[model samples]
Target: MKIPSEMSERIKELAEAISEAERVRVITHIDADGLSSAGIICSILHKEEKQFSVKAIKQLDKDNISELFSNMRSDLLILTDLGSGQADKLPKNKGVCIIDHHQPVSSEILQLNPHFFGIDGSREVSSSGLCYLVAREMGYRDLSPLAIVGAVGDNQDSRGELLGLNKEILKEAEKEGLVIVEKDIRIFGRQTRPLFKALEYTTNPYLPGISGSERGAIEFLEEIGVPLKRGDKWVRLVDLTEEEKKKVLTGLVMRIVKTGGSVESAKVLVGEVYTFPAEKGMLRDAKEYSTLLNACGRRGFPGVGIAVAMGDRNENLRKAESILDEYRREVSEAIELLQKEGLKEKGILKYFLAGDRIRDTVIGTVTSMLMGRREEVLVGMANSENGKVKVSARTTRELTNKGVNLGIALRRAAESVGGDGGGHSVAAGAKIPRGREMDLIEFLEKEIERQVNEIDG
Candidate 1:
């Protein structure tokens, strides 16, 4: 892979920083991207024989930042998948290195972000990819698979293609025989679970009348003559004959269109699918690998995600799989409730207030899932561990193109209420005090209105 001149210069600077640091403290987000970032950095440090410790957090607060800097135990303070936008909050006295791709809040700190070079952080590349660049420069090309997992985890390949630096990382991964890119059905569970269950749980294209309903999916499969089982063994998607798959896919598309779904949505049924032939368990599929890591992150066991990312396949893998099941159940139930209750209309946004019912860590995932279904923007609110509220905001691609930036809006809003927030323009989140939930909504509503009105006016 030919490194662009600008990127090569930046990588050299980052390498210099890494070379200077002896003992390091890595603080990362408790999501798949963050987990992948931590794993990659840890591997690099371990190989280089450097001392380091890691902490995966959901959000950075005063207490968290204080703990990070106040401890004189480590010299280098590294924030991965975070601190790009919260630059002002990061302690200047400490040697801070931010490896992130979010829309950055201006600062003078040493940071490696794609957004600075006119790259789309949300879709083009993820924090894991940026981390991979530094690793590649350091001569650790074997971690490309973990970078792929991180990109998939952040939905950087959500539109059926990996863009910009993500595509480059995939190419390197292919060269290393770490990943195989193929054109196939984009649905989940193609290799692991049974076909009916796969169809039932898929929420990406979101097949109507089948998804989220076990009996509906089963009945539809039977009605279409797609056999669920052969004798005693259940049939998975990988096990299906070409003819059987054709019949099932045709029936599903027809049903979805009959339910008034768009033809464009149906057209997106098949796209580039990523596979890992040598990987065991759910990690074989990039999307499932992401879900497994997410299960650990959102369930307050980011150590498990890092452990799995670092190739621990013993009890840690077993526990991560169990956590994935629990995470799925919670998300399924929460989405169902949101669908039934519907979102509250406010200005150009549609918001759902989950309050204390949903977990704070999973609110962003839920909000993103709710996007593009009768809403210009989706806001998910949950009660935080402290007396604060967690806020997750998501905007449609249509709205994003229409000049909406939730990152700036949420960051400004959260800061106004003595909180902090910022991320990609499309998907961003914040943590605000308990009584400031309504303030956040009002501020966000006004900010979104300001953007839309600026374009319209």
Candidate 2:
């Protein structure tokens, strides 16, 4: 839980820089973690009455970087959730700051990242957690809940519970009475949706027939002797008794195994659920809150997500609910389309080209949801604006443990094809020319094979 002395000192320096800046311009990724990071920094800046502006971007690529800062006026620029991998592209004329957890390229800019201190950024902490450490150094620790939400959003809790610095942040949230951590069913929408709907909507584990099947979920519950409702009201997961919960968990594992899924899929079924009592509906639960943030950000409403994270529960929350419905529908439809069309397998990867059928902004989310369905690394691609292709790649912890670095591979592969990419060992992304999808895939296939063989060699 103790912050490394060097990391702590770095955070302190960043805090000081923020305090001294006359006007700050913040550019963050347009995802849950990025939005949460933006929310945390912006909330503190708002409290201090500092002049600041924010832009949520899909990716910190060349055109994006040039457009976002060509006419920069702020005294300081802070890039959150992103900018570590593209540090060289950042403007050098201004005081640039990077608070991110992605794998970093060498840079001289003022930055704070966990990887620099021998920590696993992918699983240990998230960009939001790093932002919270800065907030803590700035004497604002109440933002811990947002940090936890970001961690969850990044799937840092893949083991069903947070680890490393995230666990430390959870402690801060708990101590401040802002969060309640409990071990419970780790399905989506546990706080708001009915039990059948929650089971039907879960795609992380891609639960056999239950996922994407309302009738299947209901039948599974009924077959397990769990009642569908309590006195005519459909029960939520929270409404179940301890005995019924155990039965459901057991049934879920059995169902997954029976349908050819690894028991490992069930690892994510039950874990620590962080609840914020002060917040209502989906915002009260860390997973659901993070999902809501993702819904807003991915659907081109990053401001709504940021506002909700900054404690706006009226207009922004209302807008976010609609976005959530749309986002979920799109995700379900995308998954069904992918499943129906099938994935293409190469030497060491399974991939699909959405060809703009899926939005570029949500391709990564789709790729993640499609992870547990296969053993090979999954690569998802979608056509982007301006004749570009967006690529999102994901691998399991097992493959990562076997020395499969998607970040390094994708970075090298993208660079070879006149693009840029890098992230964590397990998950990464890139952007390339429109017709270069196959080139990217070919490069990844060879690189992954070499990586796997090198570890064995």
Candidate 3:
């Protein structure tokens, strides 16, 4: 675990600031990575007998930021998972440490971000991974598992692999005997539910015909000769024999191709999956844990998400479970809406405008779930309560190889119309004025076309 010289200096600065502070407050985004980063820091502070409070917000708005700055009662403020993008909007407060992986903004406050070290924040690392590295450098080694879970939460492991600094965190977890990584089917409900039902709910790299239809999933399994039961008991994905597993994957690939789905999507059918040997229950598996956290965040129960991430298993976990159920229900319904309305094609992109029918937070998830290779860019828009239109853009992983950075494109496009935006290369989002929808789209199309040509040229 040799630390890079530049990152080593920043980590040391943050550790020292924590040592000198009497009272600290942790602020993080509401996503799984944010919750995990808060949980990890909370644990570290608790162990060291430091005074701290953790808060998770959906986004940092002007009013909320002002209130936090005005009500500053703590000696130190640590912003995680966010605050890196809109650095200009942040308050000029001393003793502030922002640990984030998103694109950076210029400010005088202490900042430790992956981009600062020439690292790819979107795929190679997450805010939690960065925080975990800081904690590990401070000699808190047991928190490695939570950091790994946080990386998975952020979709850094979407390609069925962890890269760069994330790989280092995985190695630390392995040495501590906390995790076991295997090359297996990377479905959501593999260990927790029946095989058919698992396939029915699969969304990422979403299986076309079999995804939302239980009957279709069941038929696929049966056609593939995978035994649904043995000795009168239904078998889950974890129960399948290696031979049966291979057959199942082969069948899924063929099904993807037969349904006119992308062969690249079919190639994403099987990959590395991580399992926790010590933790129990559904969240014990990394992917399931991430999904539950996502459900909580999208449904406005981020506090409960943090509680569960920090090991609160009483009413909070039950409440989170209920939230997850409801979240899935909403997502399924929203997906149905999009499927029925369908996407409107305009030149190189396709889109669905849900207006006020869908929440802004859920639009991104829905866009990613329904994205296909046929459309170079997929956009989903919903009206938020704040008057601005929230837009989510998604592109296929394979398409990103063609030199498209949706995050970068979306940011520039949104800014041209007096809005704000940014995200990863594959998935990005923006907030824009209500009347500028078409203008933004046209700009995005042109930018994407030019970027691709420049890369290919």
Candidate 4:
């Protein structure tokens, strides 16, 4: 594909770096979006027959950074989805190219994010869209399918619109028959799976019965006699009997409009199951890869996730499944811990600590799950693999309506403690140095208090 004339210079620079480098290393975040971004780059490298390795990391800590720098055989390192912050920790090597959409920590890093051009990086555009920019620069338009997958994985299309280059790429993908664009309502409330299996997978709209057990969810579905699956295997809600459908539909009335701009209504249907055909043995049939990849990262073995995204098969798939099961178990246990310990609601900050094993990957999901229970801002913190404190902050539209920006507050708080953090204004995260967890929490509390006071005053 021809490079967009506007980004031609930057694209040329990236291509030159790739052509000149002896070895290349790609690092990305450990979520579905991150994996999809990594997959796009990896696919390009594979087609070009370039020597490279991919690493999926939860957070760029001192140990991981040190290991990456020490083992650096590549003349160039490309970081995607992450690395907007940590400019200080960025490898000093001359051959570094970063493609991301997050708000950067400093002007120098900010200049690298495509959003600086007034492009919407939040959901309208994603890290994958940014990577698509890089690919367009490299003259590989054929890889746009990978870019679309990354965008979708990142929830970029949840609102029924695509922004910036993503729209252009979607048009291209549609022309190539790689993607089918349709106007449809995606149901985010209640799973049609069995109670035990729903608890195991923790699919949205359906919290497990053990932790935030939605008794209403189980009763409504059971009274309707809808057969729920054991695991996350998709079941058609439309397949249920007419009476069961009415009961299940009647019970799923709690509308969960996320504050970060996903404000769609949910509808209960009896025979409206939508499926995507599998792409090259990957579970493209399932639209939940984003959640699955996140579970993999939270449970450990982020590399297994990278392998799956990179299209590894056989043993790699088995390992990924095993790791995901362990992740479910850990999440169940963590929810139990959160319930016993309970969460504290202080002004705009609602939080609970789930010991050292919970980590940041699960925080976002858990926080979103708890949103139905409370209308306050949500913040969940856990310890990282390096013993440092990891924090994920989320807010509802109610809070955003008051002009509260959790991302800015969390970034400032994390930086005040000499840590790295930044994300969208509605949702964000940070990793503080070990032993500074309380300091970070206190800082966030004060910031939230200040924001509320300023608005009220």
* Tens-digit lDDT string for candidate 3 (174-270): 8888888888888878988889988887777667667777898899888889987888888899999899999988888787777556776665567
Backbone clash count, each prediction separately: 0, 0, 0, 4
Q: How big is the RMSD of model 1?
A: 2.1
Worst 10-residue lDDT window for candidate 3 reads: 58-67
Candidate 2, 359-380: lDDT as tens digits: 9999999998777653579999
Over the stretch 110-136, how does candidate 4's per-residue lDDT look in tens digits? 224655555657666778666766666
Clashes of 1: 0
Model 1 TM-score, all chains together: 0.94
Error of 1 at 266 (Å): 5.8
User: What's model 2's TM-score?
Assistant: 0.97
Ranked by lDDT, top first:
2, 1, 3, 4
Candidate 2 — which pairs collide?
A: none
Cα lDDT over the full model 4: 0.63
Query: For each candidate, what TM-score against the reference?
Result: 0.94, 0.97, 0.94, 0.79
In candidate 4, which residue ranges exceed 4 Å CA deviation? Answer: 1-9, 61-67, 88-92, 107-112, 136-142, 157-167, 182-202, 206-219, 225-235, 238-249, 254-282, 357-360, 373-375, 449-457
lDDT for each of the candidates? 0.83, 0.89, 0.83, 0.63
